[model samples]
Target: MTNGTRTALATALLLAVTAIPTSAVAAPEAAHIEGRLPSGATYLMDVPADWNGTVLLFSHGYRPMGAPNPAQNAPDDTTKALLLDRGYALIGSSYASSGWAVTDAVPDQLATLSVFKDRFGTARRTIAWGQSYGGLVTTAIAERAARRIDGSLAMCGLVHGGVANWNNTLDPVFAVRTLLAPDTDVPLTGFEDQAEATAAAGTLTAAADAAQKTTTGRARLALAAALHNIPVWNDPSQTRPAATDWEAQQANQFPALRGLIQLPAFSWRQEAETRAGGNMSWNTGVDYARLLGQSSVRKEVTELYKKAGLSLGKDLATLNKAPRISADASAMAWMSRTSAFTGKLTKPQLDIHTTGDALVPVQTESALKRAVTAAGSAPMLRQAYTDNAGHCTFSPAEQLSALHTLEDRLTTGRWTGTDPDSLNSRAAKADPTTPARYVPYRPAPYPRPYDLAHPADGR
Candidate 1:
């Protein structure tokens, strides 16, 4: 499929120069193919001539419901070229649909693998890897489809499970409604459509923007952000704010919090509710005070409250007494069945995240570790972090280094050189031009963990 244009062009160029010997003819190049699955999801694949008996099955993150559904083979072209040059086959699918696609992604990925084997022959090893929401899909495959693959890598993933993720997102959003726009009757959940959700998001975001003008509003915003564990560092190019710099910290967190409320908490929640058949998130009986106490930015919130001359106790009391949102049992059940993680890792898994990701907080890593430890599969999972300030902000060199590390573990049945220093060193060797900053980090506890094990934590 790939030889027609290139072969003809090369032949023309060769004839223009001189007659080429028949012995000098080259083999046709590998084909890049695209096709759709029975579920209507499209997939892309690249198989090199120097096949290495290994296939890197990639899973992409969420796309908005209305966006184009194009198949992606890797996170970027550089990574794709690097892997293809090194003889690793690459393939990925655009899930059957988008927006909170956890329900369809996992199965579509396994189906893609089935097609890959049928078309390219059975691979000696298959490593599942993904970013963002796809990271959750990769981890879920590690737990549920263990027999089908060798190992997995998840970057910037929401491994804390869907229920917990939405609850954590809802906490700060609920706070924004209760504390700042108490008089505004915005539907915090059960959004009827995108327009409805967007309208609600606009109302809440305007409330947050106006609140930023006053010390009281800023303090309350900080509290709400803390409730969801939004990072104090938002801009990647700017220097990180000092630990005690309350104003700068709040200033940075304000944008991140606003973005989360508009997208994940409202707009994306609408998609999730639609897919799950009803509202699948809740904050009934949640202790906002306790949730703040568990937040990494608790001290910042307190300092801001003090500077604002706001009675922190009174605000907490008001939030505690606010009417709470409830979840539909059937919707919650659907999400749990499809999106919750059991952490029963039957194969080795490696996960990486950016330190200052606002969309999916680094604290979710702590929750993932807890789940794996509970399942007694801690030995099968290893996590690393990059000291960057955005979601999935990984360099091609860093990504190649991670792929090599997982490959080594799978080949040797032992984990080695997985430490931050070793990882950075390998990344430097992979590409000296790109910077890599793998750091040893322990994320704070997820403020409002609400999975199967921590079901009551939401209460």
Candidate 2:
């Protein structure tokens, strides 16, 4: 069977499986609050009647523009109601824009909190919960509002600034090869002339520009193919290939031909590149004008290359060898600057990630763990990993377990004991035949006990 047919079959099977009804967990009843922020922007919130001192402020992953409605697939309502049922107030907002404009959600979130206080009285403790891009917002919020918020839960959040976190997961050489020559399996055959490569790069960029205008899932898939030269409509039977193989295939396929594929698997690559390249650059310009710290230069360099049709393999090598600490130092500095926020969180925090999450790989979690650990509050943080595909979807038990863990932390300010094996057991069950290893958490020891007590103090 062709790769496309396999993908279709697999997708059909998935839809079939989801359609099969298992017992639906009863969701809690909550008051849906809709109002305009003080800034005149409209927003939505799910506030439950059961009054607890804690407010659960959730930030969603990426979504199209507009407030979430019942028909939408947003987990915000469900998550809000779930927390409300557990005795915490739930609040969130419809940020101004979609795409990378999620940074705007931070102020909207704060406005929601202000509204929650007016309607239900001030929360004694506020916990910020964000998933994916929501996680990025959560990090930003935690940084600015550490004193206002007691604790925070960042699930599969992007911890590093300026760089697309996922770009670090793949081999740099493969990244360059995939973008420059999608149809040919050749090793870094040296950089093509900038003018010629940029023209071809423009074709891929145009495809990406077109993809962004589309809202349909199919268009998303097409955009992925056109920009990244990846086959979205591939055989489902083909298990996840190694990164090397994936890159080789992309390098071998021409962007034009790959763009013609019926499915939009290639859209993700375009999205990734576009994000790493254009959107992030725009964000830096905005933040810098506001005198906010600049994002990592490493991330900027990666995006600059993609935008200018430069080769990743050669550029990364050049940056790494440069005397100015532009490459490695930038990422490290960004993490260090953000480290101050990790100390401000007083509430119990739980970070849940899937070991086999293809979209946001396990290494992203590792980077976050390293950042938290370096900040000197490792014990305060609890991480749980599932062997699941996609993003945060988990089995009923897994979901309940995570909710319960969050509930325990919110109410008692203490995390349940870390059961490394039990935490990873679900992911293990999903793929029993494979010998996948769990990367255990290893934190650097703190020099003084006070580091744990006072995270705000400079190390």
Candidate 3:
């Protein structure tokens, strides 16, 4: 999209009017506000007539560099309408740029809040929230912008931080390239441009697609997915596979495996490299066998290999023998600086995740939990899970219920109705038609967790 068109889309919420159905709480009349920040980011805001003295600052997730940039003030249209109906103000920015945008998103969101306060006065309370990459941005704000926001919500976020997230992400793509297409020449990092990245991704994806047809290929794919922490259940419409059904589980993981290699592995990696000035990911001294052993899916991988009449040991040896990739120190430092999570929260933060999110796997919560505990901020954080497949697929009832629960904590100075049963009950009250799937869950430790504290190649 052209720069002008992108700006227009970002400001469209304030420039346009929509007819809201009277059925949803009489469709509160709202005042639209739009502006451009000094950083050149476009922002949009909506405030209802009966203002609730609360504001939600939204930080959107990664958008590919070539895609259209539209400002998202809420996770979805239904959520936006419900927030407005409840007399809450909503605001967000397009961000300075997209694709792994936490660097720009945090500042842009905070700047939008500054603008809102200057225009309408300080809100009684503000909550920062976002999904995917935006979730990381929200966490950063919760850490650094405590004076500005009262609380925060992160949905299917990469809270483990960019350095950790991308490092683990590299593990799977490396496995795919080394095992599935050893003869093919597709660079994993430091791409010349999006065109080069896209081409490499296409080649890798095609290799994965072809590999899925053979038993040996399926076994290798399972190993790659395990390294990536990709969940076995990807299709929300399909029933989750039985734990011991290795065949069905591998089948479910194949699509996520292919998509992960294409997007974050190649396309997103290129964008991140350009922004960071060089390669920020490495596998220089990684032990493929030990990494697989640490994975929750290791048993599944072992079973799949046995069934395929292949030796897992041989493949691991091959992977170990392959040449390792190294990161530029400056680039690695840049990524960590912009995206690392300090886990020092001065305000309450609630993170929600689907148990089977393939993109930002639920294991990310484990890493974040470790950081928060180490930082002595565990009491300020609560993570809830849904027994569902796919990414950020929470029902409207669930979404609203989470916000209400967080708001209750902010108002009462104590957390209540946060357990699965209570959360489900609250969601039922919000919308009885949609079933609430909140369940007690504890994610296993991430297999290839990496952060500044545990730098790659021992830094």
Candidate 4:
């Protein structure tokens, strides 16, 4: 199918899948659920009347995990229903903000799992499955809930910190910095300084205010662009429709446009307005730029600069002359020190990635393998790589293989899988017409505990 056709079909399939009711297929017996960590946060888990001992607690990707909000595309209710039909008691936590607050979510997940087990009395064997950010959350839970969780099925998950997976890099601050640094040649210092100045002058706030005041479509476009680092037309004199003006231009374009904007190399250019441009759409291209020029966006740009050690009032000349610091303080803070993945893995784990996943690169699996090895937990690691677009864009065969791997680990307490190198090579040899199969699971020899290996915490 053509790319456009594929996208359209995918969108339709997504809508259809999410619209279907879980109750339609093997309705779950309602069970009382309660939250131990986040007071009063609770939900009803419908354990399938014919559920087997296998209980699958889903950790949704990048959204509110345990919340009672209606399921959307991806790991929604329909997906949960499918697992239910497979004889697994499906449990989900109404985790705060889909459990973005990791510290809070961890305790809540354990508590909810406990509630499910106590209420149902059948959750002897448990498997945690999560996609993307949900994968990270799942790993976190697995690391802590080693005694309770039998195995984990993580798709497009960063076994380590999400930031570390250069493939699955999600932080907008990093994405914007990387993109703008190359184009401007002004050293991030200049952008940071401009942001500080804009913040002090209230330039961004004023622009946001102006966009809010005006009913023009261009204004709304400008506001969003500014807020999200959409590159603006360097020539401010260019005229365009207000953002609000084209709000309904192409009804189905917004979500896809937003998804595109999230990509690492997504550039907002003025020339994109022309019809000859291949990938850029007029509304997305124009609004992206206008939003880039907003004051609020500038402030964020400045914040990243500051985080990177470029102080306010520092000229580009000074920043350019400064040495590239060895220790990225921000990275250290968000990743190494506080990150849950910094520790060793105690249980069997499987990580899945896609070679063509534009958002999160396949290299991330290697990076994670190296990081875990470096941390002295190689024995528990296994990875599977697929040659598909986006995260978890695996064929049905690939998904089945992953499911089988999870079942093996849970049932037999052993993971047999090939390493990443072989998987990558095999994927390269496969034709696009052929469905990718799981490169057999091969567990690495477990390394001695970090403390035992180095005696000084492997510093």
Full-model lDDT for every candidate: 0.88, 0.46, 0.87, 0.46
Q: After superposition, how far is residue 124 of candidate 1 from its true place, in Å?
A: 1.6
Tens digit of per-residue lDDT, candidate 1, span 1-459: 478989999989988768767678887577688999999999999999887889999999878889887888799888788889889899999999988887688899999999999988899999999999989999889888999999999999989999888778788888899999999999988888989999999999999999999999999999998887778885687579998999999999988898897788888899999999998888887888888888888999999999999999999999999999898889888888889887678899999998988888899998888888877889999999998898888998899889899989998999998999999999998878787899989898887564554445443
In model 2, the runs with Cα more than 4 Å from the true position are 1-30, 64-81, 164-347, 395-397, 410-413, 420-459
Ranking by TM-score: 1, 3, 2, 4
RMSD of 1: 7.2
lDDT of 1 at 73: 76
Per TM-score, the best of the predicted structures is: 1
Candidate 4 C-alpha lDDT tens digits along 1-459: 899999999999999999999878875564434343344434446566677787766665544223454322125544455555666666666454433345544565677678776767856678777777667778787766788787777787745453243212212222223232223322211122323322322332333233333333222332333333232211122232234323322121222223433322122111111111121111111222222333323443344344445443342232233333122334323333333365467776787866434343344455457656776888777777664444556654454456556676656767643454444334434323336644434222111111212334222
lDDT per residue for candidate 2 within 144-245, as digits (tens), equals 676767667777565443243322221222333333334544312111333333344445444444433333212222222222212221322234434434
In candidate 3, what are the lDDT values of residues 129-241, reduced to their tens digit?
A: 88888898899999888999999999999899887787888888889999999998889888999899999999989999999999999999999999977787867976688
RMSDs, each prediction? 7.2, 19.0, 11.4, 19.6
Scored by lDDT, the top model is: 1
Q: Candidates 3 and 4: which is better by lDDT? A: 3
Error of 2 at 135 (Å): 0.9
Regions more than 4 Å wrong, model 4: 1-37, 40-44, 64-78, 98-100, 162-337, 395-397, 417-459
Give the winner by lDDT: 2 or 3: 3
For candidate 1, what is the lDDT?
0.88
